[model samples]
Target chain A: MPQCSNCQFQNMPGTTHCGRCGASLLLATALIDVHPPRATRWSKTWRKSRFWHIWHSLNHLSADLARRVDVSYPSSWPSILAAVRLIVPGWPQLAGSKVNLGRFLLGGYLSCGLLAAVCYGTTIGSFFIAVAITIHSIGLYDVAQSSSKVRAVRISRILLGCGLIGLFLYLPLFNLVPQYAAPFAIRVNREPLRVGDVLLSNRNAYVWARPRVGDIVLYELNPVRVPAFEQGRNAVLNLAGQRVDRVLAVPGQSIVCDGRTLTVDGQPSPHRPLNLTFSSLQVSLIVPPDHYFIIPSGERIDGLLPNNENIVRTLSLIPITQIEGRVYWRNYPWSRMGRIR
Target chain B: MARFRKLELGKGLPGDSNPDGPSGNEQAGCLELAVEQRRCGNYENALRLYSRALEDDKSLVTGWLGQVQMLIMLDESVEAELWSRKALELFPGNGDLLAGRAQAFRRMGDKGQALLLSDGALKSAGQSAYRWMVRGELMIVIGQETHLHCFDKAVQIDQDWLVPLEIALIYRDLGAPSRALGRIRRTVELAPDRYYAWFVQGQVERDLGLEAAAIKSWRHCLELCHGHVDAERELAQLEAGGWSVGRVWRRLFGNR
Candidate 1:
């Protein structure tokens, strides 16, 4: 069965058009992952790889190490009680909500994973990891208890349900969707955009209007092509794309960077050069229609502008078509979670 | 250093410099084969052969250069820079390495370092057209007025069609569509059947506001390379904008 790209409705094999919407089904047929099965694809690929062998090897090694260490469980009851004791703060709220224990445990697990993912790129990794592990232990205790209704459900089904929920949460969180509205982590500590600031980009926002000057946008490029320190510090958070930048000039705008300041249409604009050198000082150009001059916010210049513009477009200016979306909002670090512009 | 010295004397490393074994010429032979593969658009195979060549003789400068060149073509600039730096550690001050690193830096968006390295490359040992091309790009980055001279020098050194195509792109960025069109015309003359030439020609024409001509060029490009994404997109955009009244209405009161 081929899934329609438009409506996502399953269509008959060899169908040229979608049955629901009459849209072309070519893209769906050509790309099998358009509507991938929940877990079948993973199991199939796992069977092909040496995953089981590696897993068994690790399992045996861990078992041998456990035997050598002679570390006992030290009463599973104490561990369970300790885990429950940790979650006592939330028990009152859980009791008042009338939600099932399974649902509550699932919520705790999700919130922890989300927090860990959101903080993974930051300096406080250990804090998030600890919180997540504690929550995970609590969830495990809930499942192990015979009195809890969650323990009555099959472990495999519970795991599958939790896995699916996690996957759904991750898709939008990681901007994996073709049309995604998500948060972006600011890697460069520039004037306007500080490191660890989370910005929200609506990838589908520019469907009608052209991007204007002064619009801070989340555009993409080949990260391997963008210049940065080789020590992996200042490494792009998104391996597939460049960092966030502001649009200084839109299509058909005459712009010049004379190594000191930017001039848009003969007047000196407030935007100043951040990175420049003697051998590569100035650049003046008319922004071609369907293209935009996107530069990181600060006194520094993007390395692509002065030299490699011809080789890679995203170095200085980017095609409007390549823009993921406008960075309309910032939604993280609590202190800066509002309209970005 | 002694290992490198022994290798230089053609007397060490299995499958490397040992004259009585697989000879140092194999590295050169592998590089040539990789270059041929790259020319034929077999980039992955070229990369693999370049890597194999480098493993056999780590001191092979051309092998490193070829590998980095292929990586750059594949848009793997980070890997290219890493590889270039590794080669530079072993063969510091080599002109090609300096120039290659300069290119990697330029792509990485470090123009200041790129310019300094490009200057060093030009002074130290770069006589090749590729070296001159890198200089031209660096010159443009530095706000030099006569950057075109560097490109002209590159063309003078080697009349490969790629140099002109790059030069035309520079001119296009500089907002001189006429000059870009002139250079791209030369590119088309040099390689008539090349779809990329036609595609670029269409872009130049579009910039010049010659929509019909742009459409014709893009159509020619599509005929050459069927389903070319850029050409197809450009064609669709042109067709969409053809209805002036509807476009004006949409602009006046939102398409939605």
Candidate 2:
């Protein structure tokens, strides 16, 4: 039954306009929302067709379209573009520009999977490659069916650019990208150290042992309680706090900072050659099992600051188990970025 | 050492224990499915669908109570209690919803609060056998001198109660086996069709050393109450030929 959007009234399903208020009955006739809330804005482009769902999926759920729990309705083109975003990811934001990002992922995945399978001789990789090929073929078909270059350019640019980027990512200088990515930190002097900076640990760096003394290490400080039922399960703990410091003490070692001097394992730590290591304040810290002690360059010179503003000349030994994948490069603010030594 | 697992009660959900589901566009159709699921005791899947439907639209109250019942089944009282509050925000004067919340509070060891909520629900004419049963449970956990009163209330509210007969047996702690038997017999006189009556009758007969009669009554309860876990366990223990008068006495009174 068709209902009027303005007044609470129902009529025959075929009715296009309200009998009394003359309000557009198209939403009811086409969309079948017989009891639409009067407060919400009504869409005028209602058509009672079998393909109504396709239109709804495209427009209502588009990533490019902003969700308004108020007086707004999605336009036809945006809706179509929205649904295309899901099937061809990155399409909504990248649709108009001359870049086609679509070409790389689907084809790149297949190529990578095939190469992995050939190199590793794993059937698991082959199956993954097959799924990639299938998606790529679907993407290829979609591109060919596109009526205009503007509609397809985003997919094409993505392919060429991504393939080029992927091909060069593991190479030499290009690896120095993370320094530009996260721009919160700044480096001073010869120490590849930056204050107000948080570094992502290179998990792969310490494959055999922990990060050594004077080597800045990144570790998560988030406190997450793992239930007894899930003690050893892989948990993606979010970082609660962040600090970058060089290793000062490891397991079976102790540290006591006293009046601008530091002691590791009951002896003064080596601080002369590294001019930046000037932090000295008296506080004894024990290095627990499977943990690392990292001391920062700032602390190496300025003793422990009460407010935690002065970088510690000494930091706790980071646990080997508390490691995440290494972030080796930065790539934000093109002017001041380099390898996070 | 096996740590004593806590006792749980009531499947208090919104989509459950209600004729109409939460409000939605397809409410009428969805509610009918919920009703069918409830009758068939396919409460788990019915609950999942109700919650999913609610997620699609929080305005839908059908899944709210359905979630309550599912939580009761899952032994999740805290979550069920939270959901009851959500359901109440929509249906202010809803008696069933109030009773469901009361059951959640009871599960969390807040018997005093649970009793008050149950009383409120009953005053609002949520006077079904289920509400009365909840009241009976509140009395047992809060204080058990009201066993007869609660059992009678449950039976009076719904004459054919399978629950009252079972609740009466908790009187073994009061050192009155005969009184428990009397309560069970009364339950049978009122609700002959209920499997609980027959099962309680079997236990009484077993207490009185009538093993053959006990077996007969228990088997009959099993016939009526398919997948009755407690009854099945009892029957299996008896069938193993290890059960005797001495064993039964020790088993029932060992802890006491």
Candidate 3:
């Protein structure tokens, strides 16, 4: 047992510093037990460089590599992963080659882009496809080993990409999807729409109703001239991830947003007022018949009404018809991003 | 504060203005929405978004535009004009700024200068279709000398319905359906995607006493465009078999 010479922290034998405050515990031999030992404090838990954590991770990786490094791989493990190293889905069961990965990726990119172009055209769909294919190509690059098998797959992918491009070229002639699909679908541009979440009014939605609070909706704005993903990113998913916010407010529901707080019909939601500007907000709307003003949690404030001639004026009044659609899912972050709460 | 994390986006007004940092139109997106907020007369919101958007792409055009518009909406047009000028300096030949300036001039009762500046804009932007269209509109309102030149140029460039669109409007106002019909017919070809073109075609058919054709045109417009109040009324009239003079007047001007 050793007590820190400078501090009251007592430590076990051979302990160099006070577990509590890094004080020298080398000189004073004293009682080891002070209080019932609680789990080591957060700061004391890893006093030294967490080399063990790194060592553990590295060890796991080493084990994985060792497991794969077979003395006789082809003969022993007839596993999916082992097979995958040589081949991919929907490919001929020929002698699997390492080089095929690059070709597959190239093919995927070209095909996807071509298909998207054929389906959507250059303005919206083509551009998106091109970006998406490029993303898949990166993974393919990692697998290419310049073997003959890789060459064959590359050729196949190129053939597929060309077919897709050809389709795009003749899109109008072979238009598959109509101008509009499903007379009226409850599609929310904002996925994982929260219970009280609102989204940006998609200019592409309904004929009459202006978007209002209490309406869970799909928000799809007009195709931006320069899309968020375009020009700034090289990845298709990155481009697709751009989104607009939606709010849900109910009409005649004394909606109040007081700076950093909100109350909708006297019920405080999970979302609060954003204190950007208190003077311009008004969230009092009379929910139109058959339509709820779908308000995201924080859009209204006290004394903030839609007709008040301020930023929040729209929040004050919402027609039933303006409700676009309810939010159902969130497709980001993978973990926390799921169905709207 | 935790609650505000979720509501922050909801509170933001569309348009914002950031007059100092950069160009707005170049940035693109909600980042450029501040100018729209100003256009919609939400000044306080315009200011907030402008500040935020400026943080992203400082040289956003709409940010400055929003700021200027907000200043103007707040009855500080002088400051607004200064901000507008700064944005103009960034873009140099921005149609939006020119339009904003023209509006500012009109508000300030400087009609002569406003018209002159607008004219200069039209002449300088003789190659641009949107400019020509804007100029044609100004000329039509005041019967300026550049009307025929601007209108003809706009038509020559693409005529993609816009040129014929103007001609149709002119003829409609002049009570000349015969001429308007020719222009609208071309407009329909140029912009098949536009419901107004179809509606205009229906209008011409109605004026010519071709009830069946008018009904067909209206129905097609309604089918293609969807939720057109004018098409709805016209279809209703045809269904009822009793179209009135009042309805006609509203159809021609008010409903349109």
Candidate 4:
């Protein structure tokens, strides 16, 4: 007869599932007693063997360690090992014999982590990373609870284990997300911001401080309609993307430019366009409120719309809300790694 | 030591034989000796004997059942459950093996499963004192008043002194020392020479606060089983007047 591990039902011979409880009998194995029987001559001889001596020694070591740790019944070295196995999220759950939940958590954590990695630096990636962290945290809590039957021991273990995990794993990722601090790789060559130089941007910089002249800023470009010749008819093309540039003028300042030389409030400005080359031009305007004059990076606005004042105004003036972050450090290309000027 | 003896309740004495005694055969003698060892509270020895008997004769259902019962007595409920399943494989639908598995489940705290298995045991082919006793234990676990009727049915099925002794042991464990005293006294009357009975009787008397009767019972138990460590310990504790406030509180209302 095969016994159902779930309900302990004794089914007839050769039964695949339990007749009473319908639990599958194929995977059910009988529980074996680990305690040795009373010592007899045969048993004594067996105990004297090298295998028995090692096993006995290991048991004693685990018991001693458990006692030293104040972990009572069910908190042997195996349970502690299970708690430590939280590195893989669901490994501890599997060690604690929660097979179904362990598999689900492991699958979820791995899948979410893989997706987050594949879609790194996007909103979707951050969402997946958050989900993965939540799953890992749940696994940690589960392992801690299963580590001991004592309430105080379980709670203490949960706090200590979760605290360490949060410190090492969650905290760094939490700080990185939500525009706290973000890494950006410079793809185009712009002086001081060369290609392959990775910059760290403090997204929270302008939260309390105002954007000042000479500060490198990361800002989103609003879509603009540009005339395009398509299929022999004039078509409107939408152009939008992000750009990193230096602030040349602040709000309420008067900016005057004659092609190359730039002046702000009747004085020559120290800031130069980071992406655009010096050219002959004539422009004079008062910086609008809540807007900063930023040099467009490598954009030939005059050539795109010759003599179009609207294009120059739209390209030069950036709103305060558009300022995404302050570039603080150039982190990549080992030789040039330092705080951004 | 007293706790161990309270469970035994002289139910393991050699003379209080199992009603399902071994059949007259070559391996019967080994099984009979195993039964005697089990009666004498030497469950490990009894288990080894049963294994030896099974090695010689695999068809002997009693040998398998005895192994399972001994494991349960030794508080190896997991081994009992496994062994019972293995035995059931050989003798499928055997009522006694089902009851043994039920007892294992009960000890393992699976009361619902235990009740389910016990019901199957009762409806199976053969009826035995062990099966009724398991049902009675299940009843007691559920706080049913009909537990006594179930135990009485077990006693009626098997006239051995072991039946009442085991019933008294169960009663005492469930914190009904008053009810246990009657059954234990009957056990002592039936088996006067069994020192384990007097030991259990003393434990029940002590639980009821009958210090004088408990002392007398322990003395008699020591005389029958000379140098019995548990009996001597009980007498020593009594002589030293070691009843503490906590012990008194436990005696009065700990069961509740």
- Chain A accuracy as TM-score for every candidate: 0.43, 0.33, 0.29, 0.50
Candidate 1 ranges with C-alpha deviation above 4 Å = A1-341, B1-60, B70-78, B169-179, B223-233, B240-256
DockQ of 2: 0.01
Candidate 2 chain B minimal-lDDT segment of 10 residues: B166-175
Residue range A150-268, candidate 2, lDDT tens digits: 64555664464335333543233235533322223434432445442333345467676555555545554334222122367644322234545446666778877664777888788
Listed in order, the DockQ scores are 0.01, 0.01, 0.00, 0.02
Question: i-RMS, every candidate?
Answer: 26.1, 18.2, 34.4, 11.5
1 or 4, which is superior by TM-score?
Answer: 4
Model 4 spans > 4 angstroms off: A1-341, B1-27, B238-256
Would you estimate the TM-scores of all the predictions? 0.36, 0.33, 0.27, 0.42
TM-score of chain B of 1: 0.67
Worst 10 residues of 4 chain B by lDDT: B13-22
The digit string of per-residue lDDT tens for model 3 on A97-144 reads 222554555566567766664344223454666565454434433333
- Evaluate fnat for each of the predicted models and list the values in order: 0.00, 0.00, 0.00, 0.00
lDDT of all the models against the reference?
A: 0.64, 0.53, 0.49, 0.75
Off by over 4 Å in 2: A1-341, B1-74, B144-147, B162-185, B194-216, B223-233, B241-256
Give the best candidate by TM-score.
4
Give per-residue CA lDDT, model 2, range B1-256, as digits (tens).
2454454546544444345544454555455566556433355556666654554354443466667755654455655676676566445545667778898777655665687788887786345655665676676676666755766776777664444554454443333556667777777777677676787778777776666667777888888889867678877767567657765775678621
